[model samples]
Target: MFWFLLIAMVVVIAAVTLAVVGGGESDVLPEAAPQHLTDPLPLTRPVARADIEELRLPVAARGYRMGDVDDVLGRLGAELAERDARIAHLEAALAGAQATAADRPGAPGMFDEPPADRPGDLPDGSGERGEDR
Candidate 1:
């Protein structure tokens, strides 16, 4: 009886292995994704929030397809790099402009200061009407 059970288990394992490995009777293998052959990301422009929100990735046996995720990540990395470079450039330009403005102290700034001719006016920002202590 034990020998029979052992033989039965072996046969079941063999059958499963053959089914998984594709026995000599079949040469074709299942494709990972045959329907969605192309990626959904747009090639002409940088990816937007709407694009990511609308994007759908293919699913594999384990999880989302590796290639599809890789492509999306690569595109996002590129977009971030471009934005970072642009930010750095603008910051540098702003710094230069601020430095140039600093060279002149008497120049009136964008905000208006309190009038010195006003009654009880003081250089300090306090609007006090009390005695000057």
Candidate 2:
């Protein structure tokens, strides 16, 4: 009778464990599913500095794929740095040009400041000079 009772208890415990633990299937979404969190972002517009800085990725069962995320962030940082440097260089060039024009003798009032609407003719170097007469 004691053996019978012990066997019945073991069966009850096994049944309860199986019922509580669900099944062998993982609760996490599969990596390959279309609706999965790994979908690529559509970069239709340029990513702003704040957008990149505030970016977050979904966490998987083992957390995010750190190496991949780090690589992308590194690339974004480099690109942002390059853009900032280029903007600074261009601004300095414009300031230098304005200063040079201001210092020239008989310069027009426009020399010390940039016009609100810059004319496109300046880039082609097509200004009418007396030599062309």
Query: What TM-score, to 2 decimals, does candidate 1 have?
Result: 0.55
Candidate 1 structure lDDT: 0.77
* Tens digit per residue, CA lDDT, model 2, 16-132: 998778666676446673223353433665566676556667555687767657766776777789889999999999898888877888776454455453343455566554456
Assess every candidate by TM-score. Answer: 0.55, 0.47
Those runs of model 2 whose alpha carbons end farther than 4 Å from true positions after fitting are 1-14, 20-58, 109-133
Candidate 1 lDDT by residue in tens digits, 65-126: 78788988998999999999999999998887777766769775334374566534656757
Candidate number achieving the greatest TM-score relative to the actual structure:
1
Clash number for every model? 0, 0
Q: Rate the local accuracy (lDDT) of all candidates.
A: 0.77, 0.68
lDDT, residue 63, model 1: 82
